[model samples]
Target: MTDIKTPKTWRSPAVDIYETEAGLTLIAELPGVERDALDLAFDRGTLTLEGRSDDIGYQRRFRIPEHLDAEEIAAELKDGLLTVTLPRAAGARARKIEVTVH
Candidate 1:
């Protein structure tokens, strides 16, 4: 009988999100994922993250709110932890209005 190879199974990473004055922040636990092996993308109000290591892999997706600015999104990977910051669009952020006497 010939030997057959089974495909590798991937797992989802642990993630956490937080609400801030400017917008939202996402934190993902990527134990074995290297910075160069990680992929992040935001499009059409959706956020996608994927990563892989020699032995394991991870993937996850999130629906971003319309108010968030996808163009200015940023992320960082450090010590096996990934931090993503989604800043609110200029029009969506809270601002102070000045009242003038007529």
Candidate 2:
């Protein structure tokens, strides 16, 4: 497991996190945040989001789940909402096995 440390600029925001069969989804209300101003980064099993909305600064850190494939993560900003999708790691993906008995 990677040790995740929140940055000093991190701020708790009103957001919702949900997990689905495909991946993990994060929805954050970032009113007045422009697409170009928002930044998303993932490193060492830590996901960070930072941006400036109307001169107000905001930062947040999320502990990336062990099952999540940080390299495949994607984020989008639209209608003042930031949506992040994190795909599961290879070892974490569901697999099927068959057994034969004689």
Candidate 3:
């Protein structure tokens, strides 16, 4: 008799997104996932997160807008919680300008 093994399934982590005047904040719950096992990437205006632990796998993806500065994106992981901050591009920030008559 031959034994068959099944491939592990990826689970989507719980995510929360909030919009502020300066930028967007994303929080994800990735229990049991360690920093060394986590992979974060930004490509073609899309943000991807992947992680794996001994018992579970976590994955999430979000489409990033052009107004957000991908180069300035930052992420932090602690206590099984991951926080990603996407700051708005300089051209995207709202600024007030005084109008002058010629």
Q: Which candidate ranks first by TM-score, i.e. highest?
A: 3
Could you give the C-alpha RMSD of every candidate to the true structure, in order shown?
A: 5.6, 6.8, 5.6
- Give me the candidate number with maximum lDDT: 3
Cα lDDT computed for each candidate against the true fold:
0.86, 0.78, 0.88
Clash count for candidate 3 is 0
Question: Residue 30 deviation, candidate 2, in Å?
Answer: 0.4
lDDT of 2 at 29: 81
Candidate 2 — which residues are off by over 4 angstroms?
Answer: 1-11
Ordered from best to worst TM-score, the candidate numbers read 3, 1, 2
Mark the regions of model 3 whose C-alpha exceeds 4 Å error after superposition. 1-7, 99-102
lDDT of 3 by residue, 26-67 (tens): 999998777888889999988999888765778888999999
Clashing residue pairs, backbone N/CA/C < 3 A, model 3: none
CA deviation > 4 Å runs, candidate 1: 1-7, 99-102
Instruction: Report the C-alpha displacement of residue 22, candidate 3, in angstroms.
Output: 1.1
Candidate 3 worst ten-residue window by lDDT:
1-10
TM-score between candidate 2 and the true structure = 0.80
Model 2, residue 2: displacement in angstroms? 30
